[model samples]
Target chain A: MVGVIFKHTLRHSWLQALYWGLGLGLMALLVVLVLPLMDYNKMAELIQNLPPFVRAAVGVGDDLEYAFSTEGMIAVGFFGKLALIFAVYPAVMGMRVIANEEDAGILDVVLTLPVRRWQVVLERFLAYLATLFIIAALVFLGLWAGAQLTGQALDLSKLAVSALNLLPTLTLVLVFTVFAGALFGRRTVALTAVTLFVVGSFALETVGGMAKGSAAEGLRSLSFFAYFDALGVMRSGLAAANVAVLVGAAAALLAAGLWAFQRRDVGV
Target chain B: MVQSDPIIQTENLTKVYTSRRSQTRALDRLNLSVQPGEIFGYLGPNGAGKTTTIRLLLDLIRPTAGRARIFGLDAQAHAVEIHRRVGFLPGELSLWRSLTGLQVIRHIANVRGMRDLRCAHQLAERLQLDLSKRVRDYSSGNRRKLGLVIAMMHEPELLILDEPTNGLDPLMQQEFNQMMREVRAEGRTVFLSSHVLGEVQAICDRVGILREGELRAVERVERLTHVDFRWVEMRFREDVPAAWRERLGDISGVSEVSIDGTTLRVRLQGDFDPLLRAVSGGYIRDLRVKEPTLEEIFLTFYDGDGKRAAQPERVKELA
Candidate 1:
């Protein structure tokens, strides 16, 4: 039954997933195409002289020195700065899982079937997780395609690792939306809450990076974006500890969502 | 063991919808039972908790204070197992509008782990539904037909339909009635909720009337249709007499009497022979005796004081 629902969800949503994947991939490719046309040494100087808040918003941290490199420019400008926009796809997918269906009264039909409530939620989540992986793979391909097009001697492994890092953070956002959906059982409420969380996390991370002192740092630690070190992973390598935290949080949210959904009235 | 038990039963089944401001007791403590091989019509007006009771039985919503059982199993605890044997059509049917009707059928069929599409295709053909069209393009009637097809294709042992004939034309309704009769013939049970009294009278063996979250009466259809009340219309040669209206009202078993032009209408209950004997010698042009509609019969159960004069033995407890 779980597999049936999983396949059904995939069949209905494959087009939406394709659009998100292609759009993000194209953006990455376009950024790579324009990277080499400018002088990085001057660009890096300008980025450093800019207001700290503005620089942080564009994902330029103390690693402005690496901002001169092709990998750094693409990582900061495309991946890090626009991470919230990429997170929107997962947010929408998560809400659509249960909350949107319940609001539409479609949950009434599905629940009357021989399948359990938890299976529907779990299977749909797994389907979305699979689509997220596909989107990440497409993004890596886009970065690789740009490297080939620009004739830059970039390490493909590093680009692959950078793209894969988006998964943990994106999964966290997706499951958080699912959690809110199960808890609230209203599409508008769940979507509003998830959007606030995503947008707020981005703003806090950017402001915390610019402000001085422990209080500011404490606020940054509270933001999910604080754990997603996109630039560091692109420039260096994968961090196991950060990935574990994100995955652990995502698993917890999903479990809580299943528990709430199983216990609550549907289509109320 | 299952054959001896009621196909559907509720013991003090209750549902209360609550919010920040107020709480509505949607379904009061309802105790009802429907045996196998009978079509049990759950009759009620809108907002009368018919849908609420059905939702409770399906376990779509939890009850505030009681439980429902199906096939001798707890509805909430063994819902999945019960669902395997039950077919349901919601009062307000909503499907995945983006998918073609065929796709929706295939999806639900797959979910039920059924490989065959023969039953689904047959039902669609019988219902005159085009499965190739996307549901968004389907008219309201077509959507209802699709819902019916989906609910019956699995051929479950129990069919729970809410407003099953809404939006269907007369021809389609007749066909649906025939389908229901066939299901009954196969010795399966159907628990359908409807405000359409004629459909209930035509197909149901028994009915339970619900009013404002309370089960008012449960009786066999034959008994209800044969309830003593009836309407008698007579055309007299030159108005009979103005004083006869008062005289007829004075007789036993005669309720309301009125004369409009040359036609005299009388509401009668029990033996009509007394009224017939009184009017036999009159210069009458014509006479018509009409059976009371289920609606009228139901009105008798909800009198001005909200009390039914002739309560069935089983429903006396509710009274």
Candidate 2:
């Protein structure tokens, strides 16, 4: 049953994943395209002067004496990409899944299958996890290829840790979408809630970063997007505290989604 | 007659849907049962709670009060097991349209823990389904057939269908009926909800008629046959006088008498003797008798006057 669910979930969403891969890959290629003009030495000095709190808000986790050092650039670049993918991929795909099934009346047919109710919700979630890992691999490879072409080999340790940061936050987004799907009576309502959460986080992150102060820094912590600073990981190769927060939030969100789906009045 | 415990049995199984402004009773406190190997027909009009009842049985939705047991297990607690044993056909057949029909069937088969795909292929052939095509491209009848194939391919012990023959033509309907009879021949049960009266009368051993969120009647096909009523209209050569109208009204087993110039419409209760007696005389020129159908019996129950005629126990349960 698990295998069957995975097959359907993936085959059905292949088109969406394909588009995301192409789009993100092109964005990664831009780093290679612009590497020729970058004055690495001057860029490092500028990064050093940037406020420590602002850098932390954007996931600058490690101390950086020379910002141009391969370590510092890799940390910022690695975690930055991780944070964006976590926000983007799930918001795009997770928005419609549960809500769309219910709206289309397909959920009725799905529920009739011999599988348990919780099993259905969980299996789809597992499929989401599988997709998340696959997409993460694609994003990593794209960046690696771009870095190679530009004559800059990323620190392998930094790349691995960067990918790790994405796993937890991506899971959180998918779970939130599923939970919203179960909570609302209608499909549009579920999608709307997911969109609001994703877009709202990004919007708030922009506000907090652009307008700097104690309150702005405090607010940045609330947005999941602001937590994964790739440059920090490039220098220090991932943070213990951030990983704990991400994993904890992901587990909590998935549990809430499962509980809501189990008890809610469905079959509309 | 041979008797066995019912595969599905409910005593006062009720589902009340409460929203903010209105508490619409979808399924009232209704008692119904389907014996093993019986083709039980659950018939009702629109908004009559047929779908609600089916949903409750599958535990897709919970009931406000009362209990439902399938295979002698609590439906809510043992929903997973019940689902494994029953093949369900939703009245509104919507499915994974992006996938091929074949894939849908295979997925359903796997979920039920059944390995055989031969039944699926055979049923597809019988139903004339093009398994290679995506479900979105299939016509209404084809989509219905797809749902039927997925629901039946696993060969579950019980079949719960909500209007199984919605888009089927007469030939296909006959085929479906034959297929259901075969299911019963193997000592399995087929519990179907339908608005198609002839389909129910032709195959069902027993049927329950629901109205206004209540079940008005539950009886064997043989017993309900006695309640059949037909309407007969007669044309008179001469204008029927007021005295004749009064006499016709006094006749037994006649209801809803009407006269418009040359024609007189009168509803009959049972035997057509009174109708024949009144019109057989020289006053009548031409006559036509319209058969009473299941729709009338159903409408009569909801027509308010049939409240007493309907089972009082079931009626009280609705309130």
Q: Among these predicted structures, which one has the highest TM-score?
A: 1
TM-score of each: 0.91, 0.86
**Segments of candidate 1 deviating more than 4 angstroms:** A51-54, B1-3, B227-295, B302-306, B311-319
lDDT value, residue A82 of candidate 2? 43
Chain A, model 1: TM: 0.96
DockQ agreement of candidate 1 with the native complex: 0.70
Evaluated against the true structure, the overall lDDT of model 1 is: 0.88
Candidate 1 docking band: medium
lDDT of 2 by residue, A100-136 (tens): 7777778788887867667777777777767777666
Model 1 residue A197 CA deviation (Å) reads: 1.5
How much is the lDDT of residue A65 in candidate 1?
A: 82
Residue B266 accuracy (lDDT) in model 1:
94
Q: Which residue pairs clash within candidate 1? A: none
The candidate scoring highest on DockQ is: 1
**Candidate 2 segments whose C-alpha is farther than 4 A from its true place:** A38-86, A95-97, A153-157, A210-213, B1-3, B232-255, B259-264, B269-290, B293-295, B299-306, B310-319
